[model samples]
Target: MGSPAANQCYYPNGRSASTDFPCDPGVDDSPCCGGGLGSTCLTNKLCSGPDGNIVRGSCTSQAWSSSACPLYCLSANTGGTDLISCSNVTRSDTSYCCDHNAFCCDSGVGRFDVVPSKPQTWATWSAAASQFVVVNPLSTAAASSSPSSTLASKTSNAPFLTTTPPGNDTTSGTPQPSQPAQGLTAGAQAGIGVGAAVGALLIAAVVFLLWKMKKNKKLLEGKQRTENTWPAVYPEPPKMELVGATPLRQELDGSYVPTELPAVTDRAELYGHRV
Candidate 1:
C-alpha cells in the first residue's frame, strides 16, 4: 500500500498510516485494528447538568461553556471497540478519544473556571464513545477533524494531550525530587520476611518452654512428701527371769516329765553361813 496522506488515515498502531491490514485467513481482525487517531469512534460518555444529575448522551465542547477551564477531548478506548473500524467517521464534532480511565489534566482561566483542585480525568464506560476534544485555544488534531472548526475552550492555545509524569509539577514544567511511594522496597520486603521467620521461631521456642514448665509444675504437685519427725511406740519389757529355777527334762515319746534331778540351793558365802 502507498503512504497515507498527512491528515487522511492512520493504521491501528500510531507509528504509520495505512488503508487496510494485510490479509490473514483464519486470524480475522487484530485487537489493535481501528480506533486510530482520526478514525470514527463512539462510546458511552459522562454528561451532567449544572445540578450534578447524570444526563443521557454526550456533550459537545460547547456544552461546557467554561472556556476559562482547561478542556480536552478524551477517548474512552474501552473494550474491543478499538478493534472495530472508524471508516464511517468523516468528521469529529462531539466525539472524543479517551483511553480507558485516562485523565486529561487541565488548568483554568475563565469565569467559574477556578483552577480545579484536582484533574478532570476520564472515567471508564461500558459502551463505545470516543472523539478528539480540543481544550486549548490553539488548533489541535481534533480541530481539523471536528465539523465546523469550532472549539469549546475559551482560550487561544492548549496541548492536544496534557499528561504529566510523577514528581513533576504540571503548571511549573519543572521536575521535583522526592521520596517514592511508601511501598516496601525489595530489600525491605526481604528483611520483613526474615524478621517474620525469626519471630515465628522465637514464638515456637517460648511455647515449648511454657509447655515444659507446666509439665514440671504438674509433676511437683503430684509428688509425695516424706518427713522423719514422728511419735515413737515401744512394747512393755518382759518380767525378769527367776534368779534360780528347778531343772526339768522332757521325754522323747511326746510326754513332758521332770528329769531325775535335784534342786540346788544357793550357797550364801564361803563361810557356810547358809545351806
Candidate 2:
C-alpha cells in the first residue's frame, strides 16, 4: 500500500513558491495521478510560502489573478483540447480553476492530459511541473525555431518524464512524442521584456530627479540660513571738509564780498572728545 502521505499534495522536494509549477488550477481539489483515494490536493494551497509546506488556505480565483499563485489556470473552453497542444493560459476562474468540480485539467506543466475525474497525483504533478526550462526569448536560435518546435523541445527535457511514464500508443506500442504546449509567442515575450526595461528606466529617472531636486532645495535653504545668521557691514559716511578756507568771492559788479568764517571744531571734538 502506498503511504497516504505520498499521495498528499505538497510541494515536491526543493520546490517552493519561487519555482514554476504550472498546473491546471481547475482540478486542485481532485486526486492527482498516483495518489490514492482521499489523497486529493484539496488539503492545502497549491502555492504557498518559500518552504513549500502545505498550509490550509483557499487558492481562490483572486489568488490566480493577483499572481499569488502563478499556475496556468485554464477556463472551461479547454476541455476537449489535447494536452500537448493546449494553450498555457492564465485566466480568471468563472466555472473552473481551483474549484472542486473542475471541468478540465492538465496535470503537469500543461503536458499531461488528466481527466478532472482522474487527475495526476501530488507526487507526480509537483515533480513534473517543477522542472521548469528557462528559455531566452531574445536568443536568435530560439527565434529561428517555430513556436511549436521551441515549446516541444523544452517540454521534452523534463526530468520527471522518465519518472512518470507517458501513456503508450495501443497499436504501435511506442511512446508518442510529447506535443508542444502553446505559450506566448517570441514577439509577445520580446514586447514584455522591452516594456519591463522601459518601465525600470522611467522609474530610475524619476527617482534621480526627485533626489536632485531635494538636494538643490537643501542647498538653497542652507544659503538662506547663512544669510539670516550674519549681519552686513558698510563703509562709513564721508566726513565734512572742516579745515578748508571760508568763502570770499567777488560779486557781479566787481565788489569784493567777504563772508564771516564760522568756528571750526576739531575732529576729536566733533567726535565728543577733547583734542
Candidate 3:
C-alpha cells in the first residue's frame, strides 16, 4: 500500500528505524542514530539544534560562526553556570596564559589553569599589582589612615637645628684647676726688680773696700824709705885730763919710757909762791 512497505522498519513517529534507510545523513548524524547528540559527529559545521544544546563536535577550520555555540556547549556539557567569551573575561590573579595552554576556568569554583610563576620583570610584584586598585596612590582621605611610624622614627633620629648644641655656651665658664691660665703675676714681677737692686748695692761696696786698701799700702811704703835715708844719733869726741897721773915716757927699743909734762898753777896760787 505505501510503496508496498519499503524494505525497512520505521518508528511510530515516522522516523527511520533501520541503519540502511535513505536518511538525510546531515553534518552531525551520530546523535540521531542513538537518539542522543554526540559532539564528535559535527566537526567543522554549524549546530542545527535548539538553543542551549551541546555542539556535536570540535572545530576543524577557522569560521565566522556565532559565539553562542561554544557558550552553550560549555554551559550544558561542562556545567559552567556563568559562561563568557575568553576575551571578555577579566583575570585578577597574578597569572598569564602562555603557549597554547587552554585557559580552563570555572564560574565560582576557584579552579583555573595558569602558567608557572617566573621572575617578575618589574622591580616588585606589588608595584605591578597596585595599578588595579580603585583609589589614587596619593589619596589620604581613607579611614584609619595615619603616618607610618617607620618614617617618623627616621625623621626623629635625623640631625636638625633644634637638637644641635649651642656654640656660645662652650667657652662661657671658668677653666678647671688642673688647667692653669696664662700670663704674669704681681708678686713674681716685684721679686725680680728687688733682686736687680740688691746686686747693684753689692758691687758698690766691693769698689769702696778696694780703694781704702790701696791708700793704706802707699802710706806704709813712704814711711819705710824716709827712715832708711837719715840717722837719728851723733858720734862723741875723745876726753882730755888736766892732772898727770904719771910722767910721760919714751921707750927705746921695745920698752916704754916716761917723759916730763907741763902742769898748771892755779891751785891756790901754788900755795902762795913756790914752796
lDDT of 2 by residue, 1-275 (tens): 22322223322211222212222233222112121222223111122223332222222222222222212222212111112222343121111222322222243232332111211223223334332122211133334434432222232211111111133211122234343233454456778999999999999999999999999999999999999888787779898886658877666776788998678855654457676
Question: lDDT at 61 for candidate 2?
Answer: 25
The segments of candidate 3 whose C-alpha lies over 4 angstroms from its true place after superposition are: 1-183, 235-275
Off by over 4 Å in 2: 1-184, 229-236, 249-275
lDDT of 2: 0.31
Candidates ranked by TM-score, best first?
1, 2, 3
- How far in Å is the alpha carbon of 175 misplaced in model 1? 8.8
What are the per-residue Cα lDDT tens digits for candidate 3 across 1-275?
11223323232123344432111121111111112232111211112222433222221111202111121121122111222222223333211121122332222222222111111111101234221111211111111222321112121111111110111111112111111112233344567789889988999989989898998889888998888887877667788887888979986798678887767655554346665
CA displacement after TM-score superposition, residue 265 of candidate 3 (Å) = 47
Which predicted model would earn the best TM-score?
A: 1
Q: By TM-score, how accurate is candidate 3?
A: 0.21
lDDT of 1 by residue, 1-275 (tens): 21212123222122332322211111211111122233221111222223332222211111222221122221221112111111123121222222222221111110011111111212221123332232221333324333333334333322222221232222232122222213333455678999999999999999999999999987776653222233355668887976669767676787677787558877686665665
Error of 2 at 132 (Å): 41
